[model samples]
Target: MNEAIMEKVSADPFAKLLGIQIIEIEEGKAIVSLNIKENMLNFHGAVNGGVIFSLADVAFAIASNSYGQTAVGIHVTINYMKAGMFKDTLTATAEEVSKNPKLGLYRMTIRNQDGELLATADGMVYRKKEQFA
Candidate 1:
């Protein structure tokens, strides 16, 4: 793991606000975790889909930008496989599938502590010339 990249991603305010923790990061991969909270639940009592998507998005963002380049999400699609309850620990792992100078593709999976699949997402990012230090 590069300390510079880790430090940059660690400073994200939205991730901080959601209590998302970055467990690991590599050139094209990242793992992040979050513990479900009461406020994150939807009216039906399950963890909100937006929260799950945000957790996965954070992983995707970190991995895509791990090279120190500025990367912005261009397209994303997610499928919810199961419901998450309060206190459930969710982890989202994102891996780079392919990339070029200007574009990158990634796949992310969200799972519960019990190792059950909660959601899967596919994302695309537009790699920019600017860099992150």
Candidate 2:
């Protein structure tokens, strides 16, 4: 991992606030994790959907920008498949599906520590001309 790139990803305030950990990053993939806390629960006691979405989004962002180019999410769709419980550790893995000069597509999957799938997402990003790393 490049220290500069890792530093940039780790410096995101929302990720920090949610205790998200950037586990891995490559040219077109990323893995992120989050330990669900009681405070992160929804009214029904399951982890909030937004939290799961954010985790997937972080992985998507890291993967899309892993090329050192500035990539911004243009479209994303997620489907929740399972409820996440408090105290559970969830992992999100993002993989690049396709890309062109100015755009990229990624797929992200969220799973529990036990390997049960929780959610899946498809994401698209618009790559900017500027490089961040």
Candidate 3:
């Protein structure tokens, strides 16, 4: 499903225009990254919060689907610990904190290339039964 999701997301003309990429997927975790460019900067010349949030969300989407089942986010709360700088390849990793038969909890950290913590995110996702189940 990761490959399928990536294809669907990348097939979008707008995302293609923005050059977004889904980098890697691992066990109960995902690594997503994008370089901060001029268009992504806010008024103060820092990376926009929406961009950071989207990256974190992408990581969550991949990690929550880690167990070979579908999952959908029920809640997501993000704390902006620090401002993200421009021109850096912002990376976010989402790790599953806990899970049950019907629920999953995840925490994600957004960091700059040098490993400075930019934002912290937590989300609660509900696991869905597989279509083939």
Candidate 4:
């Protein structure tokens, strides 16, 4: 992945707030992790759903743009399967599900340190016209 793109993403407020890291970026996938902190919890002390969603969203952003050809997210359907508690690291891995000349479908999972799934998402990305594939 491009260093400039990584810089632009890491500068986002929510990413900085949650302390998310872009662990790996490859041709068609991206993995991001967040080390949960005390401030990330809600009134009940459970990690907020928005935080999990953000992690997945960022993963999608990086994955969609990983090819060095810009793309935009058309939609994403996210599901919260479990609550993340305690201070722990959460990882999200997004992979391309399908692709055509113009559209790509991707899915990602947010997992706890133990590899237990906390959330899942399916995203649609629209690739722009460019000489690069």
Query: Using lDDT as the measure, which candidate wins?
Result: 1
Screening candidate 1 with a backbone cut-off below 3 angstroms (N, C-alpha, C), the clashing residue pairs are none
Question: Least lDDT summed over 10 consecutive residues: which range in candidate 2?
Answer: 1-10
- Report the error of model 4 at residue 23, Å: 0.9
Of the two candidates 1 and 2, the one with more favorable lDDT, higher being better, is 1
Give the worst 10-residue stretch by lDDT in candidate 4: 1-10
Q: How much lDDT does candidate 3 score?
A: 0.81
Candidate 2 lDDT tens digits, 1-133 = 6777777887989999999998999999999999999999999999999999999999999999888889999999999999999999999999999999999999999999999999999999999999878
Per-residue CA lDDT of model 3 for 29-133, tens digit only, reads 888788888889899988899888888888887788765677889999999988887689888999999999899999999999889999999999988887311
Give the Cα error of residue 82 in candidate 4, in Å. 1.1
lDDT (CA) per prediction: 0.97, 0.95, 0.81, 0.85
Instruction: State TM-scores per candidate.
Output: 0.98, 0.97, 0.84, 0.86
User: Which residue pairs in model 4 clash with each other?
Assistant: none
lDDT of 1 by residue, 74-123 (tens): 99999999999999999999999999999999999999999999999999
RMSD values for the candidates in order, in angstroms, are 0.7, 0.8, 2.8, 2.4
Measured with C-alpha atoms, the lDDT of residue 75 in candidate 4 is 95
